[model samples]
Target chain A: MAVNKRETIAKNIARYFHDGDFVNLGVGIPTLSANYIPEGTEIILHAESGFAGQDGAITPPWDVNDREACDRELNNPKWADKENGWKIGHKDICDASGNLAILSKGASCFDSVVSFMMARGGHLDATVLGGLQVDEEGNLANWMVPGKNIPGMGGAMDLVSGAKKVIVAMEHNAKDGAPKVLKKCVFPLTAINCVSVLVTDICIIEFIDGKMTVVAMAPGMTKEELQKRTEATIHFADKIDVMDIVEE
Target chain B: MNKVVDIRTAIDKIKSGDKVAVGGFGNVGGPMNLLYELEKHPEINHLTTISEDFQMSETPYNQGFTGLLLNGQIDEIVVSFFGHKKAQAKVDAGEVKLTLIPQGTLAERLRAAGAGLGGFYTPTGVGTVVEEGKETKVINGKKYLLELPLKANVALVKAYKADRMGNAVFAYTAQNFNTAMATAADIVILECEKLVENGEIVPDQVQLPGVFVDYVVHCEEVHY
Candidate 1:
């Protein structure tokens, strides 16, 4: 059976989180990293939308579509009949992507001003975000495409600039098969020299001593295969290891 | 003094081309009733709208900036995130001038305006388009971009509860930009789900003081 690439990458990224780390997970593949956090290793999740310590997300059909189907599966009929749909949590409690969130035990919420203060004030231990392009200089371009797709930057700029460690979790290449780890980013940059680590489906690269260093590769993947998929110039560490893909 | 007023009276204070700062992370603390009232007054056109994000929904009941955008009222918008597909189309078509800022900078700009600061320096947008045409300074050997303060003519904020005196208590994450926006605007109008007597709310628990709030209006509870 083929490896679940997304889960594999997420699991590898989760290994970076230490116990009691205050972490922010960007939308898309980065959000999946939360589910792969090793057991007994707790981390506080921060959402720039104004909250921290989110434990998990509610299962979708965020809105109740088929009443009969909802009634058959859900243990609580009341949750299935709510106006916002069969949500395990409150409608107002959501991540930046508007997915209903199930907060952790000690979850606390605040306004955006203070929420961003925690981000810009250098309180976050780490933040994992998606990337459109990452350059050899550790520059990341994930916010906008200019004249094409301009979904605003949100808290990405602040997160990358302020977090103690910045991790980029993304696929190795663009959907069109172009290498995303580029020699230079053509798109608008989110931040400069901010990415500390990059985790892709096939490899894990970290910026160390001002160089893009490949420290790990997916099992059965050769350096040449990864080099072909990456556009940025990278150096392999003397002892490269297979990335741990097991969930536990 | 009592600050409670009817919704119409509160919204009527807005001018034709005033800059309006709305408080919300999407619609969490959005002043939907106030924005809906503003939308009904098509006379108030060519306004500059500011918010964290403009969330678009097909649901008619959702009183987000989508109505103002569709009504062709907003001439410009400054936001951190805008996922409204139709609004983006309008932006690409050269209808609305969109200025995107980093989220932390957006919040700090509003705070700086409220705090009466000239501007602040930060490293958020050093090598991006945000640094273009902006002052750059090297502090302690690291480059920082100078960001100016952002103030507005009026601010519309929402709260879970408020006293007639305008002291407010926000519920959950609904306090997103409301607190900062209240202090940054010339006129601050707040809509509340519940209204209480001046002495009912404990002073220590007040998230926003009455001094920053100009008017208070009771609105139907915002569902989600």
Candidate 2:
């Protein structure tokens, strides 16, 4: 069986995150990769809420309250002493992680100007976001749907502009079975020319020379097959690679 | 000390056809006084607003001011870009014109305008799709990209606290581009929630001094 879109996108994001990199995760499916950074990989997860090194999965429990925290910090030997650094609350950890941005000489609350400045100032190394659509130019349009009324645009815009490397992780198609990788987005924009890589369920796409270059694929999905489902032209790489591991 | 009512009236003085630059990154914090007063000016039109991202979905940015974007206004917008769905609709409807800029370039242009620079060349957009129909200059045997300065007639800034002198501070995440915007605008109007006494605000705590601020409207009716 072919690897699922979720696994494919998960692994694609793993490529950018090696070790000792400051990374920020968005709210949607991009949040799924919290525990999938691979074994022996050193990555510091930065939660905007203030967590610097918190780690955990969104507790999925069918028996109890299924909705749980998306973060967890295990008592790993390398992270902290077994007695010193135990399993900590991700929310508490993120909230404790304050940056130099917060120690500004003046201004108290979070303003748009300072917020965007931190983002635009390259505070975070990598930002993994979700998108409804990504074009050949690697432009992402995940904020809205054309006709469907929805919620307000979230931190996607800030994440895109400020993060050093922008990685989008999403499914291959829409709920109605429409291709999300399109020629152009039909909804309002969040940010323009900010997307760096398109990590989708079916394939891994990146903007090389202002065009989408397919560098990897789902286990069994070929470039031609991935293109068949996507409405936009598929710019395939000369060779496609296999995904590394499953999302833990 | 003007009451909340007078502050709202002061905001009402903002007429239509005003060029404004709002200080807010996404939407967490904004000048509620200005936004509220803008609601009264339904007669306002052809407004050019410069903002970071999601801060402009409200009334003044919604209807009163003409968007200088690829989607909002009839004229033109110089911004990093409108992302996702909104960009598509604006492009499809052919309602507005858009000039997209790289995030760094846009921030720098705004910063350059604030710093009183004519223009700067960066190798960022060079040799990529971002380089199209732009003047290319060779400097020191290398190609550099060029973008113009982003100046505004008026800049609207949001802050957490302020002194009677009109100095303001920004909240976290919301302080994206306020200072650069404050310098670029001809008249920088600050919308502050907390206004303390002149000496109440410490000199060290002031981010933008009252010298750059033209008007100070308190946050009387702003939603938290």
Which candidate leads in TM-score? Answer: 1
Give the candidate number with the greatest lDDT: 1
lDDT of 1: 0.85
- Candidate 2: global Cα-lDDT? 0.59
Error of 2 at B155 (Å): 1.5
Candidate 1 CAPRI level:
medium
Candidate 1's residue-wise lDDT over A1-248, tens digit each? 66777888888999899999999999888888888888899888998878887764423444533335434444454444445342334545567776555555567888777888888778999999999899999999998777776778998998898899999998888889999999999988999999999999889999999899999998889989889888888999999989976433
DockQ of candidate 2 against the true complex: 0.09
What is the C-alpha lDDT profile of model 2 across B105-184, one tens digit per residue? 65667778877888877654554445778788999986666778888888877777877677766544445556767888
DockQ by candidate, in order = 0.65, 0.09
Q: Candidate 1: where is the Cα deviation over 4 Å?
A: A58-88, A246-248
Q: Local error of candidate 1 at A72, Å?
A: 14
TM-score of each candidate structure, all chains considered together: 0.93, 0.61
Instruction: Give TM-scores of the second chain, every candidate.
Output: 0.97, 0.79
Tens-digit lDDT string for candidate 1 (B110-157): 999999999999888889888999999999998999999999999999
